[model samples]
Target: MTFETDHLGFLLNPLDWQPAWAEQSAEQLDIALEAQDLAIIESLRNFYFEFDLSPPMRPLVKHIKNNFGADIGNSIWLMQRYGESPARTLALLSGLPKPKNCL
Candidate 1:
């Protein structure tokens, strides 16, 4: 499907998010992500599929470190991409639900 930029600048097609869609979402969030960022999205997608849930910050960070390794799993580093609410931003970009209890 053709995606267009929303007011926020990111392209969103929430009903049809695949891992590839993260790039457009990141653009909307007004950040340019590195390869690491894309990898994180892939990991998040895997986590969502396996657990049927989106992860909160700590868990998301931990999962990345555990699964993808230290080169791209630091919470501080992730916070830089989406500010203090990485989980919310990530869920939005990944087209998953905001992590349970996220505000």
Candidate 2:
């Protein structure tokens, strides 16, 4: 459970990521990951694999909308589920590098 993370708490080596690590990370952030959250994490991982970088909010929302539909992909839902910074929270949970524009 003691994995290397950056100062921002993102995984230092994305290759080290595992589902259990995400659960642990979510716990540290006081997030209780639901099945929907896990699905979004998988989608984020897919996005990273395709683009080679974590997405900022707009793209994250768009991507989620594409994959999960508008009902669950909007900013309000994301904020409700992951707090003020969904992109940052999701990037950490998905074990991807933080989105360059997240902060």
Candidate 3:
């Protein structure tokens, strides 16, 4: 399925997001979307709904820590799962806009 994505590959419209789209996006990123990853993606979507913006890494980590727990929330675990730029990757996979400060 083809999605309307921004230059950085985030979905142009958050409402266009779907689980299947996320799976395809993850595949494109070469990261398999497991249940844990899907949970994080749902969290990101919730964050965007609450804050009206994608979060930067620090806040993303903190939010994850708050929601999931320390083991899954640290930068190391995020990096291992999403690579060097977890915030950007998560934003993309979550079908949210890129975090304003991601670049």
- Among the numbered candidates, top lDDT falls to 2
Q: Candidate 2, residue 28: CA error in Å? A: 1.3
lDDT of 2 by residue, 1-103 (tens): 6889889888988889999989999998999989989999998998899889899999999999999999989999999889999999999999999998888
| Winner on lDDT (1 vs 2) | 2
lDDT computed for candidate 3:
0.91
Error of 2 at 57 (Å): 0.3
Model 3, 1-103: lDDT tens per residue? Answer: 7899877777999999999889998888899788988989998899999989799999999999999999999999999889999999999999999898788
Model 1, CA-based lDDT: 0.73
Candidate 2 local lDDT, residue 13: 88
Ranking by lDDT: 2, 3, 1
* TM-score of each predicted structure versus truth: 0.74, 0.96, 0.96
Q: How many angstroms is residue 29 displaced in model 3 relative to the true structure, after the best TM-score fit?
A: 1.0
lDDT of 1 by residue, 47-101 (tens): 8888987899888888988987876578777787678889888877777776777
The CA lDDT of each predicted structure is 0.73, 0.92, 0.91
